[model samples]
Target: MSHSRRSILGAALGLPAAVAVGTVATATPAAAAAVDATAWTNLELETGITPQPGATPQVRTVTILGTTFLQARGAITCNLAADTKIGTLPAAMTPPTWYVRATSPRNNSQGINACRFEVNTAGSVTIYGATSGNPITWVQFDSVQTIWR
Candidate 1:
């Protein structure tokens, strides 16, 4: 009679337990190689925001384990009004309306500028956390987690 490992152990320990028994089959190697799954795609920025030198503002999206994540890094400059639309992400990668905080260099002059950003379902990106006297000099989004819906 074939017995499961759990059953054998339970019997050896003199304990009552439910055991699951199954056949052990040998595995076969795949005949073909797997394809590349690099799916990081770049997003475009709006006209108001300019990519800084060597720190160009960029946004990208990548889906892992059926969940899509939006990642924005680098530096950008926008002298527009508050809540100004900055850019649009891909429809598939865009999440529901979310307000996230980013860092700015000149806003506080000490690299602690926590600028609020709005990421909407339509893929619209906006900055609504700066005042007239504190226009965002450069915003960074490398540390924020933006999950798409």
Candidate 2:
């Protein structure tokens, strides 16, 4: 089934819209105020994962209007050539009970070496798929964003 533009935008903004009419709806003040950013907190990497060269990993919780968001940035490297756990988030910034995926910076193999990461409700952040032949040693978060609440 196809979704109307109004419905897609409504769902993304956490608002209700008249999907049948197929018209765009103006965002409420509450929704417009969702751009506020909070201070960044230093994120400690899990054992076995270390920041690459000059990169410093960090996280922050921002309240966009009524919705809570978690943001992470910087880069890291893993000591093991396998799925690696990156770090943990604070309780207040813990995401909803789901796997939130983010893409790492592209590798030398013409971007085929990029890896996927998942952040769970337990605040554990992990990167998947690293092998001996094509080891995923470096990852840049690039201000990854996910819903926290």
Choose the strongest candidate by TM-score. 2
lDDT of 1 by residue, 1-25 (tens): 3223355457646633333211113
Task: Please give the lDDT score for candidate 2.
Answer: 0.67
Candidate 2, residue 106: the lDDT equals: 38
RMSD of each: 12.5, 5.4
Model 1 worst lDDT run, 10 consecutive residues: 18-27
C-alpha lDDT (0 to 100) for residue 82 of candidate 1: 56
TM-score, candidate 1, is: 0.56
Write down the TM-score of every candidate: 0.56, 0.67
The parts of candidate 2 lying over 4 Å away from their true place are: 1-34
Q: Best-fitting candidate, measured by lDDT?
A: 2
